[model samples]
Target: MNAALKQIDAWQTSLAPTLPTLPGNDIDWLAQRRSEALTQFSDIGFPTRKTEAWKYVATHAIAKTTPALSQSTIVDSTQIAQWRLDDCDEIVFVDGLYHEGLSHFTANANIDIKSLAESFEHSPDKIKALLSQDISDANDAFDALNQALLRDGAIVTIADGAVVERPLHLLFVSTNTDNSVTPINNWIFAGKNSQCNIVETYIGADTTNNLTLSRTTINVADNAELTHYRSQRESKQAFHLAELTVKQNRDSRYNAYPIALGSAIARVNVEIILAGKNANCTVNGLYLTKDKQVSDHHIKMYHAVPHCTSDQLFKGVMDDSSRAVFNGLILVDKDAQKTQADLSNRNLLVSKFADINTKPELEIYADDVKCSHGATIGQLNEQSIFYLQSRGVARDQAEHLLTYAFINDVINRIQLDALRKQIAALIIGRLPDSEFIRELV
Candidate 1:
């Protein structure tokens, strides 16, 4: 405890310099929340493989180094144009800091975007309410740190009953000068009866070893709908960690699709709270790891109100000496009767030395509620392989096609066809320079 406390103190002292230098804005009110978050991070500095949620994942490579911050890299229009999605608005952040000149968005009367540091003066109460609402601060460490030392990030507000037809892209790009850790925080709000879709992408430098810590919280109001996708493609030596928590209101829909393909060590968390009756949620994810990398996904779903429903599916593929982990928990409260929830995890090992671990949990208190959990860990079916090979498919091509089919289920579930294709291409693009991806249908 004392050691953690000291670490918190160090974080407070070390990160003070990075705080946004702007005068009175939302950040002033956010100070207390940040301190509390720092406290939480200190109490849980780095989770080890022994931790129930981290058993199959070891974060030693990430915990051993605290890289110094570098001058953030800026993405110009040419670079931004590379990621243009169909019917989308883009907001770019370089190395956790806002790159105003590099970002472009059409002005909408009802929608607004401002830096956390710059918007402090608009509404102290609203800002304070934003910081600590919807989250239980005791269980998470990195999330707490995000609250404590977070300097700047995007704050998006959608007006009541408004619908954003275009997707909002929150892009975070890293530049390599050294092995510094960059933390990016995102705060989002979907008003009552509003609709929104957002994408958060993390990119790393080509040469320098970079580490990114990202946190995002979304508030879905009554009758609102939110669709979110996060893509992580950090540098080869980079370490990436991110957490997403969604709070749902009555009759609201919150859906998330997270696809991770880069980074040496990656950890992602998804927490969905069904706070209102009749709410619905779906948490879906896909990840692929190669060489000596590691990736993990942890999910928690809570049915606190009656008439709520949740479904979760996570899929992963590991090749070479890489490793992947999936941990999911579903909880149904006693009074939350008529609740329906299910959790499933499917994984594949593409190489003899690759590793995979999966765990799905269910905690139900109501007798009338329905809940179930299942997980599967296996390699490609040999019979299917034999049939394909016999049908004139080469050995490597057959293996690659089967592997693509294994993960294609998750791809097919993505609501956005373009995003699905982008993710598929990313996975195929990294196919070890072999014939594996070329043969996939």
Candidate 2:
């Protein structure tokens, strides 16, 4: 067998002993599902560059390491306080296990928030019904792996006709203690006519090479509104892969913002399905990488019903020998008349060796649909830099300003004031002459 298959077999061997100890192991349905998913993962193994969906990023570093379970590391509130948002309910997970001691969230009648293990143990029937659902026609090896080892995560459910005044934040932290791997599977249900905002952040220490495989399944009921923001900041030696699949009902609105930074290799996949008439969604993203880091984003927006709409905007900045990839697709079904879809990807390279590969596609089977897609890859305009330099700005500062401005288009879409400012500062601090731009941004 090849090296990739051998690596996967090793992982399966290591993972077998721990399956019976998981929360829902005794449930036959759940056990069968886990077994099936594990078999699927074993058959496919780790994705290689030959995989069309993962052509730009590599998995050798992650596959070579024997996967171990994540353990808690020493991290004080002060170290992570900056990542939190004020006036919000928050839950903290350390190494994939819910850390109730460090978490703070008020009890509300209209919402139910609990860890996946706890929820499964309390009500296995409901959890089983919901967890059994997956993306209709998508087969992903990471997602299958996540299912095979899924033990703990978060479940957020909003009551019908309820409006949550405060946003909900889920923080997943990986300590820099060992070469461990964490698989997180989250399920979110928004009731009819309900409204809520959610923020999901994945962060790791700078000293470890951890692997985080996470997948979020969101079900939006009719006329519900959900705004989601996800940010990733991993160590230079770490590998991160995340998948977000959202299903929207009639007259519902879903907006998502994803920011990627700080990892040797990171890939995010987002799939949004408009399953009901008049459902709509917007996706905005930003990624910044330096050194030998690689960041990638893939998006698929499907309009399966009439009168649905979607818009996608993604931007990236690369320096040193870092590389980035963006692939977005907008699909309109045969009966989906009056569908409106748009997609755009823009990238700016700050170093001569930095590279970007972008593709924006449109697949429409309906004649009445309006679909458009485009991608732009280039460096900072010298004329614009000269214009700023002529106005007393130094060359380095001018370059920094333009680069900051290029990424700000996506950053500005963040609705939360504190999160937006913090992300802007983080992005600015990664550029040359960052201090000067920090105060200016």
TM-score of each: 0.90, 0.96
> 315-335, model 1: which lDDT tens digit per residue?
889999999888888989998
Locate the minimum summed-lDDT window of 10 residues in model 1.
19-28
Q: What RMSD value applies to candidate 2?
A: 1.5
Write down the TM-score for model 1.
Answer: 0.90
Q: Per-residue lDDT tens digits of candidate 2, residues 385-418?
A: 9998999999989998999988877898899887
Error of 1 at 131 (Å): 1.4
Question: Number of clashes in every candidate structure?
Answer: 7, 0
RMSD of 1: 3.0
